[model samples]
Target chain A: MDTKTLCDGILDGQRRALSKAITLVESARADHRVQAAALLEALKAAQASPREALRIGLSGTPGVGKSTFIESFGMALVREGLKVAVLAVDPSSARSGGSILGDKTRMELLSREAGAFIRPSPSQTELGGVARRTREAVALCEAAGFDVVLIETVGVGQSETVVSEMSDLFVLLLAPAGGDELQGVKRGIMEMADLILVNKADGDLKAAANRTRADYAAALRLLRKRPQDPDGFPKALAISALQEDGLAQAWAEMGTLADWRRAQGHWARTRANQNRHWFMEELRLALLAQLTQAGPVRDAVARLGDSVASGTTTPALAVQSALALLHP
Target chain B: MDTKTLCDGILDGQRRALSKAITLVESARADHRVQAAALLEALKAAQASPREALRIGLSGTPGVGKSTFIESFGMALVREGLKVAVLAVDPSSARSGGSILGDKTRMELLSREAGAFIRPSPSQTELGGVARRTREAVALCEAAGFDVVLIETVGVGQSETVVSEMSDLFVLLLAPAGGDELQGVKRGIMEMADLILVNKADGDLKAAANRTRADYAAALRLLRKRPQDPDGFPKALAISALQEDGLAQAWAEMGTLADWRRAQGHWARTRANQNRHWFMEELRLALLAQLTQAGPVRDAVARLGDSVASGTTTPALAVQSALALLHP
Candidate 1:
């Protein structure tokens, strides 16, 4: 489709076209990217800006059934008549440049739902399973009218925190296992979560789940924290993804937290801060590229490193001399 | 030697000189950094290139015996007549910034030893419990012929991971009470740890310690990991820090792991990669500063973001238009 007609359809709230356009943008071909960019521009011009969707990032330990839970939880939300989009980034091949992108199969129910949009992205060895295109994909989802964007990360360290930067809510899922189970995972994930859900909370596991929740709550008291969470309060809830219990409460809790965030102006302020950081990061990449290509500095810098390595010069003097030339 | 002469004397392997120089390098003042950089250059020149040191990073959940174990471990090494430098970053300011550098006090016996250097640098809210200059301090220690440079962190979530990045071996010290205590931590730590020690394994906790180690060993089997770890095999060991039992075994395990890693070429490759990453990161920061100031693209980009917000343009197009002027 031509950019003009394609964008007009998106503005008219045609979900299918929106999906197609997002796919085009996600494609790696140079031509497709150019065409996709043009379509996005036309779409932006024609539509009144839709409400930017709420982004939530979910991360947990592997084998904790992240996809199964997202599938069930997403289906629950769709049943409530809310439009949802799920972006699942696979973390299996983070050290290597491979991704399983298995969410589509794992989340068949949600994937097949007419109102639910499920896209499984490869982390591509990104520390967080959030590829470079993720933030832009998010904008596209919002443009297409996904009220809720659920990003499911391959349960890796640091990726959840990366997702937290892009999302409005960060939910850390824990299995109903006790202190012994939680002890090896390190204290990192706990501090990042605005909400903690003890999954596998069913039948005989209820008491264990409750105890885990209480223990976590006590632990939370000791952590030096900010006043308001991305979600309104510090909430630890119990849910059974397998049994599909407490799912609605989880959804409601998310909504309440999101509302509280918006009311507190945290929603905008946080995004603004993220935007600034992202911009800085982008500029950093661009400028470095320019500097490396600009002049005699590049050659001089490389030679200097060689000298420093061979014990002929110092890294400090090399950097200083290189910077002087580049800036000059 | 006084601080002044000692700072200058660090040019040689004088312990006092090494101590004074580290303090100045880690000092927060602008003038101190200038002095530190100069001293660093001279010291780097005077010392042998790449001093042989086993740089280990120790981190765990709060209440875990990190210091207790380190002291026990350090004392074990000191008794063997190997010089040890413990850069124990103080965490007294978890809720505030004041610090007493009191880990030396925690490990009372080791603190009194002439062969051991136990200095608790303040966390001071740097990237991790590690002060920003901690890397420089580590460089200083390595230059002065310290056999091992041990970095102790505040055991916070993201901070622990960051601390692990600077060390040759990352040891995660976990408590011995192991009835499924793994739920609290995300699975990420498993990937980062070169060694896992279940501490407090003496007395009544012995059974629990064994069980915890068993659980970790089982879980590790499930992970398709790097062909080799920093500490050779993926061995889970149990140790009683209080009783000072398993010190030699633990140290041997660490040595065996390091040997395995060196045989696999990971030791050299890992450090080289880390250095490359830091260079790239520093380049990014320097580039961002220039990019924000050198081009009109910064203004154009911000304006474009506003257009996207106001429904006048799309991000894809904004990026394109902004980049077009990047050449000019």
Candidate 2:
């Protein structure tokens, strides 16, 4: 299909067009990128008034019940007659052969919902590439009239932070555990989180979940409060995705926070900042890509790199020589 | 001075020549950079055998007694017939008018010592420029026959991690406080630390210092152990800069860690990796600088950035337009 048809289908809320557009954005081929750009531009022009989805970024370590929580929470939104879209950004998928979200039955009920759209993480080798594609996928979902876009990333090296950049709200999901497991979470991630949800608050884990919640509550208090949030935000709460308990309350809290941010004008300001940030980031990546692609400059970099590594030349001197090769 | 005279003076451990050479490297002028490169190359060729100083990176927030600790530590080393050099990398100095180490009497005794050399943070506007200048100054110190080069940076923002990149070992200094102050410490910095020193362990605060040390010790245990270290490494200890207590022990511990790394060949491997990392970093900075320096491209970036922020264009499409301006 052409760009116009894709834009029309997307504006009409057709799931098939959204998927096709995402594939186009994720494609590494030069031709596909041109088409993807055109399709996105066409969609932007076709919309009468810009529609936005509440982009929520969720992250948790493996076995932390992330998928279960997402499915439970997504169903709650769907029950309220809202359209939801889920996009995963898994940099590790390239190495693991796309093991994360690879199984189709992982979110069986949510997948069956007509109001819900689920897309697996793109199998991109670099985290930057994966994040860029996922960000575009989010834009496509919003253009397709989704009420909410849930971006999930494994709570591993750097991916969660990347996701947080593109998201309005960053929710960190944790298991019901004490300080040992808490220490495993990077402090940087904790600082970035807008909310911490301690899952497994049912059966034998109820007390443990409560305790974990209190611990995180105290920990969050110790962090310097961000000026953008209202009082008592970046707090922790307990939820049970298994029994579907506390799901409504968590959803309500998220709504409250989102509404407050929107009213306080933080939502618009933050989105604008994010857009500018991504534009600069993409420009930097493209320029660096040119350096690596040029055969002569690439070879010169490698040769000078070896000399620097072996201590035959200083880094500054090596860089000087490399730049000379580029320009001269 | 010419490159030959500077090389001879550096090899002879002349403090004036070392300072001049650092000024050369730190200069942003095109002519100065050429001369600096020539001077560095000459020094590299003059040395009969490469003599390296044990580089230690120290970081602590303001009011953490960093200068006091450095003074005491440097005095101790000087008394032991070892030449010591101290260099500060304070990126904040650019805005603060070099307030961090602006006072000439900050390390009065050490500054007066014949065996100790001290350099304040470079007054560069950007962190990358400041770090690059500091790294080259470190080379000058090593060439001037210093036995130990102490690199100090304020424990705020990304400066500490940048210091860790150039040093053989990274030490985090903390005040005698509890969880509140600990929370202020970024977890990323904690992971990078090879040693944690709780300072002001004297008078009324001795017990508090010890307790803080224990807390950090436990926290360090929770972090995954690094393979490069021997057992019981990256540990915390209490020290008193006022009374000069524990300075010898801290020095001994640093020696032990450094010796272990050298024995395991990690020292050489790490330095090689650092060299290559800096080379690539400088190259990236240079390429990005070109984008900002070109008048047409810079203006286009600003115009496109405004469009992106105003939601008039998607970031990817804006980037595409910017790239076309560059290549076309």
Task: Give the candidate number with the greatest lDDT.
Answer: 2
lDDT of 1 by residue, B1-328 (tens): 3434654565445777887777776665545645665665766555556576898988777777877887889989999988788885544453453335456678888888877787766556545324445666777777777788898875655656656666888888888765466735556776777777888888898888888988887777566467665423566788889999877888998888888888888887776655544433433433344444535656776775665444455545655565565544
- Score candidate 1 by TM-score against the native: 0.61
Question: Per-prediction TM-score, please?
Answer: 0.61, 0.71
Q: What TM value does chain B of candidate 1 have?
A: 0.79
Q: What does the lDDT read for residue A292 in candidate 1?
A: 57
lDDT (tens digit, per residue) of candidate 1 on A187-254: 77777777888887888988888888777766766663665674235678888898998889988888
Total clashes, candidate 2?
0
Model 2 chain B: ten consecutive residues of lowest lDDT: B96-105
- Using TM-score as the measure, which candidate wins? 2
lDDT for B94 in candidate 1 is 37
Per-residue alpha-carbon lDDT of candidate 2 for residues A125-228, written as tens digits (9 for 90 to 100): 79888888999999999999999999998888999889999999999999999844664678889898988999999999999999999988887888659977
